[model samples]
Structure formats: C-alpha cells, structure tokens
Target: MFAVDTSPRSRTRQYSTSSSSSTRSMAQRDSMDIDSAALLDIQRALDIARNTEGDLDHSVEKYLEEQLTGVWNRLESRPNTYVLSKDEFAIFNYFVGRYQDSKVAEKAIARFWSSYQDTGSS
Candidate 1:
C-alpha cells in the first residue's frame, strides 16, 4: 500500500512581504506631488484627459492647452512671484512633451521662458 501525506504550510512571512510591497507601491502612486500649484494643475488636466477622452493625443493637447492658459498667463505676469526653478521647468517640460510633440513643446517652452526674460524676472 502506498500512502501520501498532505500538510498545510505557514504563509505569514510570505504574505507580509507581498502585502507591504503592494501597499508601498500604492502609496507612491497615490502621493505624487511636485510642490508647485501649476504642476499640480497640469497633473489634474492630464488625469482628466486620460480618464475622459478616448483620443489620447487630441485630448492631451486640448486639455493641457485649456487648463494651462491661466497658469501661463500668471507666470508671465508675475515672473518673480511664480519663478520656474530648474526642477519646475524640467517637470513642466516633461508634462508638455508627454502630451504633445517634443519639438512643438520645446518651441512653446522657449516662448514662455522668453516672456520671463522680457519681464526682467528670473
């Protein structure tokens, strides 16, 4: 006669590691802040575009254009008050490139930065 043994194995350690890793990932994704109102606004606009618009390219461009209009104007008007630090500029450029063509986004950034120079601000 042949006998087979079946037993339950403990999963406490495995479960804890997997659970904690997943929780950490969730927290990271949920708490993505860039420390700038304009950056946050751009993020919101991107979220809206991704969620609501079926056309990814068109929606990104249109939503970014609409949402960032006031932000750009504010930055232009009060260049000293709303200075785009190097990090801030990198973040802004990243979003614009993600939503549109890199070449076009570069041109737009150039123009926007020119406004800061014209205003004699940083």
Candidate 2:
C-alpha cells in the first residue's frame, strides 16, 4: 500500500542522513577534480617551460594572427567615426581569449563600439 501526505501546507524538510552523506561525497569529488585540474595546469606549464623564448613568442603571434583576422575584418567594416589605433592588438587578444570564437568576438567588438557611442566620451 502507498500512503500520501495530505498536509494543508508545505513545510521545509530536513536533509536525510543518506542524502547528507551523498552531499559530502559530492563535495569531496569536486575538490578532487579541482586538485587534478591544478596538477594538469602545472604539467602544461612545465611543458611550456621546455620551449625556447623565440618558439613561445612565435607560437603566440601565430595564434593571435589566426584568431584576430576575422575580428580585424569586422572592425574594418565599421563606419569610420572613431580614430582607432592600428597597433592596438591587445584588445583583440583580450576579446578573443575571453570568447575564443570569431563570431562572438565580432559581436563583442560591436557592443563595445555601441557602448562607446552611448557614453559620448572622446
């Protein structure tokens, strides 16, 4: 036979012992995952350290150029209102790193320009 609660009002229920134990187990697993992730990051850092400075710089430049091409094209299509700095590649790098997608980075650049216009600040 199945019995149902027929209370007139709903009330907060306390956590059961099993559920509490499960919650604790979940927290432990989460911490373990974080630890493993940190270890992986350290390994990657060591691998990068083995590379020479020129190799690292070349790789970074290659990545930035590959990622920023679409972003540059998008900026090129915009109206010539703001005097943009042609050498300002850092902003493109920042947005690309933040989104890691050309389309999304283009959209973010559009929004940035929109906000700049709205602010009316030179």
Error of 1 at 49 (Å): 8.1
TM-score of each: 0.28, 0.25
lDDT of each: 0.41, 0.38
Task: Estimate, for each residue in 47-81, the C-alpha lDDT of model 1 and write its tens digit.
Answer: 53445423333433554554355344545555444
Tens digits of per-residue lDDT, candidate 2, 7-111, equal: 363221111111223433332333233432232222222233233232332333344444345445545565333223322234364445555655645554565
Model 2: how large is the Cα RMSD against the reference? Answer: 20.2
lDDT of 2: 0.38
Which candidate comes out best when scored by TM-score? 1
